[model samples]
Target: MSAEPPVSLRELRARAEEVVTPEAWEYLETGAGAEVSLGEAESAWQRWRFRPYVLRDVAQISTSCRLLGHDLATPVLVAPTAYHEPYHPTAELGTAEGVRDAGSLLCLSTRSSRTVERVAEYAGPWWLQVYVMTDRDITEAMVDRAVAAGASALVLTGDTPYVSRRARGTALPLQDEVALVNVQQHLAGRTWSSLEQDPRVTYADIEWLASRSGLPVLVKGVLRADEARACVAAGAAGVVVSNHGARQLDRVVPTALALPEVARAVADQVPVLVDGGIRSGHDVATALALGADAVLVGRPTMHALATGGAPGVTAMLRALTAQLAEAMGLLGISSLGGFDRSLVEDVTHARG
Candidate 1:
């Protein structure tokens, strides 16, 4: 095996595939119902062409920004992903350490192999991603525990009320050893299916969570402009435009395609973040130009973790940051705030 970490996200994924078991690889790589949305998500960024300006000072490019009162070194954050143990033995703890080293934020999943308290031990701003379970008390307890464990924000995944079918089939079996430590007590004696997200969860639940927790609540999985406004009205501190990596509904609009609409609807009332098919710094630039405040990265982080553990993740983040900076410099923009809709244009419908 090569000692060096892969330079490109695509190469990193290929490396991960070589190292991990087929079952684990399938679980990470596959999306729901033929995955049309999955392919569209990454491809959507290409539809917008960048309009660069010359003869301007581009020195001192920076990717830093403040998100929900927290300073981020880069606009990139690790989107919540489940069961890291399938990729690396150190699991979420190692992922946390890696993100800390990258000077970015990490939104940990409720399905993490390590408990929130354990992952919180690492140095970084962290958020807890939650799924409101069938049991309301369990959901409340999770929010309280995550706050107590030092999470700065609560990202309520508004998608996945129920699991969707993956054409590749579910490969990773739920084993007792890798228990979801945060809610294991509440899960005791209950069938695993009981933990399936409460399909009935609604905007009222967002209100309830905001009332119960002091942390800012961000609703993820919003695709429409009207729904984005509804979440803010329901007390969401922010909204993440996502389709659960196209793992929930396969034909839903790509996050890149949906971001501008949601961002426009929210009208800066709350920060708009986006995830799904963000694989490069160019993609990050496109998202910002289209009105996203920041972008959340998922599978790339997992690929880095699988290839080289914490160090791999750190390198991947740094590489992405560098790529973003280079793109900014070439565009003659010195900061993220310089980005505007005028900087990007849809070329897909251009007539010659």
Candidate 2:
């Protein structure tokens, strides 16, 4: 382990760039066409002002929360990102061990470089992020393997019906050998892109997956309230308001801006989580105040993994959780339930 913890997220990214190839950096950082959504994601989080409550007992603030029957030390989760080997030699194994050590959860991607069983050996509480393939049988088989390997829930990524054109219009050439470990056996010597997302997948597939695997299913990449409600009606255990980290489309609403509408749509019925440009603990608190059950962090984790490996990830998660506790105390809230929509206001609409 290094003598010191990793630096701030910006520094981590800079350091990662020094060690990681330019192609890998571009694949990790850039998003779809025009990059408008990507550019606005972090700034969108900054536009919310906290309506803090004062003069209450906050000395005993707690950051603990429950999701999908598992207790978490913090609301921050590792959003499913593919091919960790590009960032770290340990691959998903290091990320899993880091998340486990930090008392957070990992949502392992269906495209992870590591196998479900191998990741389970190091991961603590984790969910399997699924991409329903052109071959339904392949998708189902993947789900079954995740179930057998001890994934707590299935996060059905609903937005990626097909790959979008990146603004750069190129990606690092990730060999199938390093990117398809989880699905390789099912591919029968075919290329990884052959396992394309099923464009025809409907809301009904959520119920079908839950029933088939006996695991709770969360629909990720939903932005519209109507779509969130539709997922719930079709038996979704939760809804993640995301634009696939702004990787799916250009100029889509950032998750911070889209969260409240989706939260109002189905938060009472199921957990509503959001991801996209969540950079700090204050951002996490703002997410909760906006009615999210939790928030997921993606690029930051990859940066940490690239720079400091597992220990860096653990340090970053701990620092965020600590910052959350501090924010809760400063906001005069003692627990996760204390946050509500009344606690935040979009600064764009504020008047003097």
Best by lDDT: 2
Error of 2 at 305 (Å): 0.3
Question: Roughly what TM-score does model 2 have, to 2 decimal places?
Answer: 0.96
Give the per-residue lDDT of model 1 (tens digit) for 38-73: 778888888989988888788678889998888888
Runs in model 2 lying further than 4 Å from the true structure:
1-7, 189-194
The alpha-carbon deviation from the true structure for residue 67 of candidate 2, after best TM-score superposition, in angstroms, is 0.9
Cα lDDT tens digits, model 2, 162-209, are 899898755667786776678778888566566989899899899889
Q: In model 2, where is the ten-residue run with the lowest total lDDT?
A: 1-10
Measure candidate 2: CA RMSD: 2.5
Q: Global lDDT of each model?
A: 0.87, 0.89
Instruction: Give the Cα error of residue 141 in candidate 2, in Å.
Output: 1.1
| TM-score per candidate, chains pooled | 0.96, 0.96
TM-score of predicted structure 1: 0.96
